[model samples]
Structure formats: structure tokens, C-alpha cells
Target: MDYFIIVITSAAGLYFHWWLYVRIKRWMDRDLALSLAGADADKRALMLQRLGEAQASGIKRGDLPAWLARAAGEYAPPRD
Candidate 1:
């Protein structure tokens, strides 16, 4: 009985963590994409080239930009 309770709670915790990760990752992607869209053409092109090289070197696509942005500074959460 104790084992069953423990397993259930553990599963719940894992699910919550996964859900939270997905939400935050999605937000980061959207934020970075919007920022890039607003950037001037030359700057945007340079950034995209860097992102492509990073992807070729084994970094996952669509992630480097957001990671770089976050490392640079924290962003405000999107309003609902």
C-alpha cells in the first residue's frame, strides 16, 4: 500500500515537470522568434547563419537562439 502511494506521487511529479518544461520551452521559442522578426535584415541573417552552424555541429535546431537570449538576460513573461 505504501509502495503504491509512493509510485503514484512520483508519477504525478514527473508529469508535472514535463508539462512545465514544455510550456516554458514553447514560450522561449515564441519570444525569440518574435524578436528576430523585428530585427533588421542583416542582423537577422547573421544570427540565422550562426544558428545553422550550431545545428550542424550537433546543437538541436530552434534552441540555440533562445538559449543565447536567456543567457544574455531574462525576459518578461508574456501576458495572457
Candidate 2:
């Protein structure tokens, strides 16, 4: 009985953790989408270019522009 209780508790904890993670991830994704939606096409392109350059040159996050810094925290790149 004790073993069964422990198993159930472990499963419940795992499920709760997974649910929380998914909810948070979805919220973040939505927030990023909204942020990027407010930007013009030119700004979006520039931001993407900046991210690419940063990745290529191994630039740190602190070196990014303010807009990008904000966007990076929420938004993901569009699908190619």
C-alpha cells in the first residue's frame, strides 16, 4: 500500500511539473509572437539579422540592441 501511494504521488508530481512547463512555454511563445507582431517588417528583418550576426560571431546577449534584448526574452524566430 505504501509503495502504491508513493508511485501515485510521484506520477502526480511529474504530471503537475509537465503541465506547468507546457503552460509557461505556451505563454512565453504567445508573448513573443505579440511583441514581434508590433514590429514592422524592416525591424523584424533587422532583428533577425542581428541575431544571426550574434550567433555567427559568438556575440553575447548583452551586446544586442534594446529591442532585440526585449524580443529575445519572449519571441522565437519565424519558421524558414
Candidate 3:
């Protein structure tokens, strides 16, 4: 009886862990897609234009947050 209980509990725990992992993976994929989409041409152009104006107004690169810097670095121009 005890052995059966342990086996059942272990199976349940593994299933729960797998379920959580799948859910987290799906959420991460969705967020990554959204991030990449935001780096598309229209979005990048808008951001670059804004940044240019900001720079002209004396908003230095060092003043921007690390996340913005990372995003700008990772952003790729959309391909045809």
C-alpha cells in the first residue's frame, strides 16, 4: 500500500511540474514574439526618430536605462 501511494504521488508531482513548465514556455514564447514585433520597421523608425529628437535636445545615451540600451542593441532592421 505504501509503495503504491508513493508511486502515485511521484507521478502526480511529475505531471504537475511538466504542466507548469509547458505553461511557462508558452508564456515566454508569446512575450518573445511580442518583443520582436516591437522591433519591426515602423516601430524602430518611430523609436529612432524619437531618439534623434531627444539627442538633439541633449538627452544623452548614458542617460537612458539599460533595458533601452539592450533593446536598441538587439533590434534588427526588418528584412524585405
The candidate with the higher lDDT, 1 or 3, is: 1
Best by TM-score: 1
Question: For candidate 3, lDDT tens digit of each residue in 1-80?
Answer: 99999999999999999999989955653444345447465755645554555446765445534434555566566678
Sorted by TM-score, highest first, which candidate order results? 1, 2, 3
Q: 6-47, model 1: which lDDT tens digit per residue?
A: 999999999999999999975665456447545555544544
Give the C-alpha lDDT of model 2. Answer: 0.62
**Residue by residue across 1-80, what tens digits does model 2's lDDT show?**
99999999999999999999989955654454346545666555655665565557765444444545665555555566
What stretches of model 3 exceed 4 Å from their correct place? 39-80
Q: Judge candidate 1 against the unseen true structure and give its global Cα lDDT, from 0 to 1.
A: 0.61
Query: How many Å off is the CA of 2 in candidate 1?
Result: 1.1
Q: Could you tell me the lDDT of residue 18 within candidate 1?
A: 100
Candidate 1 stretches greater than 4 Å from native: 39-59, 62-80
lDDT of each structure?
Answer: 0.61, 0.62, 0.59
Total clashing pairs for each candidate: 0, 0, 0
Assess every candidate by TM-score.
Answer: 0.49, 0.47, 0.46
